[model samples]
Target: MKKITVLAGDGIGPEIMASAIAVLQATASNYEQNFQFNNQLFGGAGIEASGRALPEATLQACYDADAILLGAIGGAIGSPWEKAKQTPEQGLLALRKALNLFANIRPICVPDALLPLSPVKEAIVKGTDFIVVRELTSGIYFGEPRQLQETKAYDTCRYTETEIARIAHKAFQLAQTRRKKVTSVDKANVLATSKLWRKVVTDVAKDYPDCTLEHQLVDSCAMRIVQQPTDFDVIVTENLFGDILSDEASVLPGTLGVLPSASHSENGVSLYEPIHGSAPDIAGKNCANPASMILSAALMLRQSFQEEKMAQSIEDAVFAVMNEGVVTPDLGGNAKTDEFTAAVIKKMQS
Candidate 1:
């Protein structure tokens, strides 16, 4: 049996994750795979229980499991203790670093049924399918030499040859499988780190000669993303840039609640999560959408377990549900949260 750790975190997290677990159980049974899930606490609940955002026990559970599924983290409620020291967001960042999850893959594709909801014209979004391969470790976000003075603060942006090579290689390999094209986004013209990034990625591209490669300045890439999103296939960039671009690209699909992301390690340890936050405004309300969480489970199956058929079944079911006009309020459909999840489950069983 494959062991999996489920972190049903704050707010709408538990509700949405419950739906994902149900789908996974059905998929595993149909595929004749034995799977066991071990639930653990993290985020706000973890902080309240253990005085730390990421407890040692939670980390151990993640290490022991074959894969991890995380619902959203953080909550609007502030802890009575040191606010900065007790925030739940730290738990997520700490867990990511501890697991060595260096690659984050975020796929953004506009479902055919939701084209009308897209801000972009239908013709521009008709066949828009692309994936963002982001370097999760070793970049400006975690770079060293960060310091704050009495009046000013500074953070260093750093990268190594190996860090660039690994993520670049992943991007090229992904390009070879998908569209035979890769766009390396960097600010090489301005930053020394990006120059190193450009040099290293260019060197790595030679290994995958069949995969066409190009480098674009980050500013221009950001502009073109909204102007001509369909032109992109696979986008590879550093942590900070990828974080901004992926969020921007998500708007093309109309709702942030519909996107899912996966962060993985070299040894196959993976964590699946939605891109959106714990919207404290809708904390206990059933109005929050669960599609992103369900999609994250699909990514967990595909990237970690290598269950492509089952993963595709989940994806098709989601699309079919939306195509039939059954959707959450966020997607402009009348279906309630339970109703939408039930539709997906029904489609999966059918």
Candidate 2:
């Protein structure tokens, strides 16, 4: 049995988590796979349980699991978590640090049925199926030698050749499984870190000579993503630029409620979750969309377990269900979360 540590976080998290789990169970039965679901509290629930967003026991379970499925994290302002020594978000950062999670993958695939709802034109985003591989553990986000003061405030942006190379290799390897093209986005013309990023990535590209590599200025690359969404296959960049670019790319999918993300470490363990936040106001409403969480579970199967057929089955069921006008409130449909989940499972089982 594949051990999956499940973190049903705050707000709409638990509800969507239930949906994802139901879909996963259905997929397991259909594929004849055994998944051991390990439930754990997180975010605000964790705070309530042990005054911490990631309890000791929860982290241990995650360490021992095959892959992790997380719904979402964080709590609303004025919650007790805000008053804690470490906020719920801090726990996430700590977990990332502890696990040595160095890569963040966000695939911005626009379904054909949702192109009309996307900000990009149907002509542009109709076939958009690209993934962003963002370096999570290094670069500006974790760089130090900085200070914040009344007059002088500065944060250093740094990167090592190894940091740039490993993430580049990851993108290239992913591209080998996709369209075999990688657009390395950077401000190499201006930033010192990006100069090294470009240099190191260019060197790494030689290792995978079968994959095509092109360096794009972050500015023009951002513009191109909007102008020509399909021109991209895989995008690799440092932390700060990628954080912005991935969020920018997320718009191609229409609603954030349908986007899934994964964070990978050197270890085989990875964590999958939706890119959307905790809709605290909608907690327990039974109207929150669960497609993103369910798709995230599919990503877990594909990325962590290499269960391509099972993963694609879940993804196809989601696309089919959505195209049938069966989405939840986030997609402008009135169907309850369970209704949408049931539709996906029914589609999967059939």
Candidate 3:
């Protein structure tokens, strides 16, 4: 049996998580896959209950689980939760570090049916599908010597050859499965870290002869993402660049509410979460979209459980619902969170 730790964090987290869990149950039952989901407190909920953002029990639970499925965390602005000594985001970062999750995979694909909903012209967003393989748990986000001083504040962006190679292999391997193209995004034009990144990735690319590798400066890459998103197959970059670019790429799907992310370590429990944060404004309203979270569960199935058939079932069910114009308020539909989830579950059952 697969032990999956479920963290229904805060705000619309619980509502969306409830929908995703229902879908998981349906999928598990249909496939006869043994799954034991253990719900736990995290983020603001953990803080409220146990006086810590990531309680010790929650950490231990995650350590023992085969994989983790997380709803969004972090409270809204002006709330006491945001002003706490240890923020919800700290908890999330801690969890990532604890698990040693190094590769963050975020896939962005815009279906033709949702073209009208996209801000970009229909032609531009048409056939746009790509994955960003970001080197998580490293780079400036975790670099040392970070300090705020009287005259200036500074952060370090560091990467060793090993860090660059492992993620490069992941990007190249993923590219071989896709369009056989990998675009390594770096600020090599300006940063020492980027130079090492470019060199290391180039060396790694030699191993995969079938895959083509190209390097792009982060600025042009950001522009090209909006200008020609379809041109990219897989983008591998450092933590800071990936974080920004992935958020930029989220717009291509017509809504941030539909983007899912997966972070995996070489040896440890992996994490699945939506790129979107807790929508405190819409908490308990039953109007938040659950697609991202549901898709996140599908990612867990594919990456952690290696249950491809069940994962595809979930994906196809979600696609069928979206194509039929059944979605939550965020998707320009009036269907509530549970209503939209039920529609997906019905498709899965059918």
Candidate 4:
């Protein structure tokens, strides 16, 4: 049995996590694959329960688990960081560091079913499939000597060669599997960190001769994401740029509710979560989209347990259900979270 730690964070987190769990259970039953899911407190829920976001017990559970599936965390954007105590996003960042999850893989694919919903023209957004490989544990997010002064506050953005190399290698290897194109996005023309990023990524590309390597400044890359999205296959960049660019790329699908991400480490334990955050406004409303969380579970099965058939079946079931006009509020459908999840499960069982 695979031990999957479930962190159903704050807001709509619990509801969507329930959907992912139900779907996983259904998939396991159909495939005869045993899965043991252990629900644990994290994010704002953890702070409320134990005065700490990444509670010790929860962290321990994650370390011992085969994999982790996380629902959304934090409040409606800026609200979580307003308080003096640790924010949910901070806890999440800490979790990434503790696990040494250096590579965050976000796949942005505007499938044919989601074409009508996309803001971009169908001729441009159609068949737009790409992956953003982000350096998760370092860069400005973890940089030292940061201070919030009364007049001038600043955060450091630093990286070592080793840090840059591993993520670069990850992107190139992943590109080899996809379209053999790795586009390293950075502000190389100005920033010192980005210059090093471009140089190191270019160096790493030499190791993967089969994979074609190209460089694009982060600004132009962001513009192209909305203009010529299909031109990119694998976008590799530092934590900050990757964070921004991936969110920008998410717009192609018309909503963040359909995107799933995986943060992988050298060790076996990895994390799967939706690209969207906790919609505090919609918490307990049963209106949140559960497809992202369910797809994150699919990513967990495939990447962690090597259960490709089971994973693809779950993903196919979701797409099939969505194509049948079953979607949540964010997708312009009226189905509640549970109802939508049940529809997907029913499709899987059939």
Best by TM-score: 4
> Model 4: residues >4 Å from true position, as ranges?
77-81
Superposed on all Cα atoms, the candidates' RMSDs to the truth, in angstroms, are 1.8, 1.9, 1.5, 1.3
Q: What tens-digit string does per-residue lDDT give for candidate 4 at 152-187? A: 999999999999999999998899898999999999
TM-scores for every candidate against the unseen true structure:
0.95, 0.93, 0.96, 0.97
What does candidate 1's lDDT look like per residue over 1-350, in tens digits?
87989998888888888888877887778888777989898888787888877788999999999889888888765634236464677678788888988889988899887798888888887778899999987787778799879999989898999999999998998898999889999999999999999999999999998989999999999988888888999999999899899989877887877889999887758899988877777767776778888899888888888889988999999888988988777777778777788888889898
lDDT of each: 0.86, 0.87, 0.90, 0.90
Q: On a 0 to 100 scale, what is the lDDT of residue 148 in model 3?
A: 85
lDDT score, candidate 2, position 95: 77
Tens-place lDDT per residue, model 2, 1-350, is 99999998888999999999998887786678899999998887888888888899999999999998998888777877887665778777777777888898989999887776677778888899999898988876668987889988998898999888888989999999999999999998999999999899999999998899999999999989888989999999888888788778877876778988899998668999887888887888999889889889999988888989999999999989888888777677898999999999999888
Give the better candidate number (1 or 3) by TM-score.
Answer: 3
What does the lDDT read for residue 114 in candidate 2?
79
Question: Candidate 4 overall Cα lDDT vs. reference?
Answer: 0.90
- Per-residue error (Å), model 2, residue 188: 2.1
Which regions of candidate 3 are displaced past 4 Å? 149-152
Off by over 4 Å in 2: 77-79, 146-154
- Predicted structure 3, TM vs. truth: 0.96
